[model samples]
Target: MKAVVFSRYGGPEVLEVRDVPEPKLGPESVLVDVRTVSVNPVDWQIAAGHLDSRFDVRFPVIPGWDVAGVVAEIGPTVTEFAVGDEVIGYVREDSIGRGTYAERVAAPLRTVARKPMNLGWEQAAAMPIAGLTAYQSLVRTLRVGPGDTVLIQAAAGGVGSFAVQIAVAMGARVIGSASDRNHDYLRQIGAEPVAYGPGLNECVRALTPQGVTAILDMYGGQTLTSSLDLLSDESKGRVVSLTNDGILEQGGTFVFARPSKADLDQLTRMAESGVLTPEISTVMDVTDAAEAFRLSQTGHVRGKIVLRVMGRLSAAIH
Candidate 1:
């Protein structure tokens, strides 16, 4: 099988496509003939050796976690899927080495979920990590509900975009922060756009006199500290941050959004009903993993960056 690997982490230039051995199917895993994989910030950060201390790394590491494909083979103990089930997964193993930046991946049954009928392979690939993070942060960490007003930081980015839609679908009025260019995009997804910066608090307060009932911070530091000012009440409103742990010092929750098959299923159901739609910013061939990583490092991506590992001609959803 052909896969991208890095013998030593330095930059995207260190990544190269090479022939590698096929992964053996474990009793609790499924072998997916990968159709697409999406790029997350962690992908580039790992490739750059930033997470070396956190995860045990073996040389020639393949970096990626989000995968969407068909099951080519199933493990002996696996009962939930079969020889040809369409699935999407967050394929994060215990350590680091084998990953989804390849033609196939041995995904644990616990990480796999049925691909929603309405989503394409690329969109399915885009949903796992980013969608799950947003869903868990809002639904699990904050418990956002109807009649509530929620503010999402970096709301036009990968997880933020999904967070905005999920909050709106849950009946919370959403206020999202982004540059003016993405403000209209935020509005289309149901979030009232607030230009991100010094005036964010006043902008959000202008919309709701009681201030926001919850806050989902994908960008930490100033972005988060300032958002806390918009909380309706410090004791009642909830806050969760994906980036900075300094939020914990400020009485906000810091969530890592652990991968869960159950949570992925709920996201799939929402996508099937047209409530959650993943936005794809760029699509490239699997061989172009380096270029895709370069795009991700810029941090200007509007949504998920996907790699088409199979059937690469399909158009990306705007």
Candidate 2:
């Protein structure tokens, strides 16, 4: 198997494609021949050693989470899928190494879901992490619904794109924060766009003096503080965050994406029904992971950055 691995924590420059041992199959896992994978902030963060305190760093770490692939082999105890079944997964393990950034990966049954038929390989590969983040943030944590006005930070990015659509589908009025260029794009996704910057709180206030009934902060730092400041008294428990757990102290819910087959099924149903769609900003070959990581680390992409892992297609889109 060929995998992109970094022998030590460093920059994207440290990543290299090399032949490596195939992941050992488990009784509860399936071996997938990777078709596509998506680059996420956590992939580069773990590569750069930012998550050292939280997870043990293993040498030759394979950094990736989202995957869309065909099942090459299924474990003896895994009855949910069979050989050649199309699947998608959030292939996160307890440690940081051995991931989907390769030609193949052994994914646990718990993290895999049937690929949404409405999506292509690139689109399907882009869903798991960001889709789950948005699903958990709005449905599980924020409980957004009718008559509620929800404000979502980083509204044009991967998770925020999904969050905006899901909130709108749930009957919540969505106010999204993005750059001026993405404001129109946000409106197309059913969110009322607002420019995010030094005057974000004031701009939001101008939109609705009563303040937001719920807030989901996908971007941390300034956005987290701004989200806290924008929350109405009625939104005490309606606030959710994907990047900051500190929101819990302010009566908000801090969400870490969980691998749930049920959630994937729901997201699949929504996509099939035309209520949700993934916005992909870039696609590159698996061999181009270093460059893809560079683009993802910039934190300015409008949506997801995907790597086409299999097939004759080797491309990059900005």
Candidate 3:
């Protein structure tokens, strides 16, 4: 199998494309013939060694988590899927040694589900990590509900795009922050776009004068702190950050959306039905995966970046 592997954590230049032995499938795993894999900030973060504490990577790591592929073989214990069944999911960060930046990967059954029938391989690959995180943060952690007003930072980005759509589908009035260029796209996806700038707090307040019921801060540093101050009552507003800045404040909640098979299944359904759609900024060859990592680190991507692993599946939903 040809894979993008890095012997050590440093920069994108450290990544190299090489022929590596195929992964060994476990009793509870399925071998996926990878078609596409999306790039997330976590991918680059791990490659740059920023998440060393959270995940200890074995040397020569393949750096991708989101995978969309067909089951080439099934584990002895796996009964949910069979060979040729299309699936998508995020790989365990600790299991980067068997990562998705390759022609094929063996992933635990618990982390994967059948790919949405309405999504292409690229779109399916884009959903797992980012979409699940947004869904969990809003629906599970923040408890956003109908008649609620929710603000999502970086709305044009990967997680933000899904958050906006999912929140709207849940009947919450959503306000999203992005640059001027993304505002139109965000609006089309059912979010009231707010151009983030000098006084983004006031901008949010102006849009939802009654005050936001919840805020999911994908941009943590200043965006989150400002969101905290915009709350009319702390109880009505729940702020959740993907960052570990400790800014949830007294009587508030901070969440790191943990991966869950159940959550991925829900996201997959929402995507297939068109209630949620993933925005992909670019697609690169597997060999150019290192460049994809660099793009993700810039933090300016309007949507998800994906690595092309193989030909699109004819049966894949598009």
Candidate 4:
């Protein structure tokens, strides 16, 4: 199989397309004939060794987690999906490498869900990690609901876009912070748009004087710290950060997205019902994954970036 691999930690320049052996399927996993893969910040962060302290890395790592494709083969113990089932997955493993940046990936059943029929392959691939993160943080952690005012940082990006739509669907009034270029986009996604920067708190307060009922922070450091005071007294502990662990010390929750088939299924339902739609900003061939990583590293993309796997395999008979 052909896959993108990086032998050492560095930048996107270190990535290369190469011929690698097929992934070994586990007893509870299915081998997917990958059609599309999406780029997440964590993918490049892993490649650049930013997550060295968290995950064990092996050399010649294939960096990707989000996949949308057809099942070519199912494991002996896997009964939830059979050959030819269309699926999407957040294919993260305990160790780094053996990822979805290839023609095929062995996806565990716990992380896999049927793809939303309403979404194309690229759109489906864009949903897993970002959608799950948003769903878990807003629905599971903050418990946002009707009458609540929710503030989402980086609301035009992958996770933030999902967060905005999900919160809105849950009856929360959402306020999203992004650049001027993305303000209109935020509005389209059912969020009241606010320009993020030096006066972000002031801008949010101007919309709701009492402060928001919940905050979802995708950008750490100053963006996370500065928004602490923007929460209502009753909602002071309703802040969740995807980027900052220090949020734990600040009486806020720090979320690391976990793969849950049930959560992915709920997102799929939302997509099929027209309540959730992934916004894809760019699509590149898997062979040009290096450029895709570079684009993700810029931190300015409005939505998800996807890599189309050329020459996808036909679903094989078991």
Give the number of the best model, judged by TM-score: 4
Which one wins by lDDT: 1 or 3?
A: 1
The digit string of per-residue lDDT tens for model 3 on 1-318 reads: 677788888888998877788889999999999999999887778788887876656878887888999999989998989999999987774444667887788888888988999998878899998988888888998778897888888889998998999899999989999999998999899999888878888888788777888888876676676677776574444777877547646455666556678899999889878798889899887777767777888888988998788843221212
Candidate 4 stretches greater than 4 Å from native: 312-318
Q: Which parts of model 2 have CA positions greater than 4 angstroms off?
A: 311-318
The lDDT of model 4 is 0.92
The lowest-lDDT stretch of 10 consecutive residues in candidate 2 is 309-318
Candidate 1, 1-318: lDDT as tens digits:
778889998888998877788998999999999999999999989988888888999878988999999999999999999899999999998799998988889999889999999999889999999999999999998888898889898899999999999999998989998989999999999999989887888888888878888888877767777778778765343888888878887788888767799999999999999999999999989778889988988878899999988743222111
Candidate 3: where are CA atoms >4 Å away?
Answer: 93-96, 234-237, 248-251, 311-318
RMSD list, candidates in order:
3.5, 2.7, 3.8, 3.0
For lDDT, candidate 1 versus 4, the one ahead is 4
> Which residue segments of model 1 deviate by more than 4 Å?
234-237, 311-318
**Backbone collisions counted per model:** 0, 0, 1, 0
Candidate 4: clashing pairs of residues: none
Best-first order by TM-score: 4, 2, 1, 3
Q: How close is candidate 2 to the true structure, as a TM-score?
A: 0.95
Best by lDDT: 4
lDDT of 3 at 263: 90
- Compared with the true structure, all predictions reach lDDT values of 0.88, 0.88, 0.82, 0.92
Give one digit per residue, the lDDT tens place, for model 2 in 136-166.
8899877789998999899999899999999
